[model samples]
Target: MIVTHEIPAIQTVDFTANTTYGDFRDDLVRDGYAVIKGAVSKEKAAHYVDRYHDYLEGFGLGYDRNDPSTVKEELLPVINEKGMLFHYSAIHEDFVWGMRAEPGVLKVFETIYDTEDLLVSFDAINVSFPNRKDITPNVPWPHQDQDPERPGFRCVQGLLNLLPNGDDDGGLLVLPGAHNISVEFHEQFKDEEQLYRWTNETYFFTDAGMKWLDTKGFKWVKVNADPGDLIIFLVEG
Candidate 1:
């Protein structure tokens, strides 16, 4: 059975507004997530999408933007079970780097870190295709990216949307206000064996942790964004 949870709607910050930075920071502190609308121009985002398809088609492994049938695993680079493309040097691509260096994108990080000297994280690009019988369905993995040992905020995760991501379109789902109690949650489940053993930077919440979130009335929110928009969220302690 597919279990569904009700998520509350959230207002995204307007990037062009001069007063939204404070609101964005406030959202991060209170809700654990914030969205900046039109961080990059829509036209530029469309170009980025085209470039992304170019990268895939350049592989010459039968992947084609116009043909959905060609999106098989054999034709594409290594994509994780969650539809994340971290391999095939996707991180080093020029377009990806360009998106990272956008002024609006950098300003958000600068506002959070309070300095211009910032280093970007080598993150993955997500390419989720719906109703694909050729690929495995993405499993929902609820977890915090923060290491338990590091109690306070260390880093914020950001995603630049290249396409319209609405409710039906799969995107980020975050537990609202979960970051406030992340430290306590980790301490409570300190003895539980981690689900993901590859890295300490990620702490996968167990069934008990989900129950804990429930008790706190923290509901999962499906964060939506348009092309050229940026979504930023804390690592949840």
Candidate 2:
């Protein structure tokens, strides 16, 4: 069967700090990623879900059964048992813009990365399920947010939880301090073509390649946090 992906493309949000920017930046530096509890008001988080559905209604943009664009190309998403999305981020223009320019969200990055000139890479809205057994795990591997040539403080990714993240929900997991490690192994997975992996480790390289992660003492775990929390981590420069 032939497969295709039809999805709208847009940039991730770039926010400026209006409050709690200073405190959060420190947390980001200490931990690879920090979960900001209720980063957005319940009303705002709800907006994300609303805007998500709107994007679907307006553009007919959900993952087509025949075509895998929504999951493969957009976020490598895996639907959970409850029939809900684990990571879905095909957003409308309003949602993207408002999130990018979020004052509270951006403030933290500006201070920690120590640059007013921070930019966000386009990322997918993800939803990971708790206890969803991945016989073939497809976790998002450790990599910088920006391109290999320029991976670091200048470019970062922001993940904000619009919903509740209890123990049941498999929160995001980042390898602590793996940001400072070398990108040499990342070279193999560098190809933008490495998108679909329905079987193999969704986020792992070859054995030779994965050996690199072990060298640096890679640590992977769910990014635990309540709703309205956001996490920003630094990439290598």
Cα deviation at 35, candidate 1, in Å, is: 0.4
Per-model RMSD to reference: 8.8, 10.5
TM-score of each: 0.88, 0.57
Model 2, C-alpha of 217: deviation from truth (Å): 3.3
Residues 117-147 of candidate 2: C-alpha lDDT, one tens digit per residue = 8766553555443343432455445434344
Lowest lDDT sum, 10 consecutive residues, model 1, at 8-17
Q: Which stretches of candidate 1 lie over 4 Å from their true place?
A: 1-21
Best by lDDT: 1
lDDT string, candidate 1, 1-237, tens digits: 979553432223222224445557767766778898998999999999999999889888889999988878898877766778988779989989998998989988887777899988777888777766676777778877866876666678999998999999788999877777877887788998777467777888888889988998988889999999999987764
Per-prediction count of colliding residue pairs?
0, 19
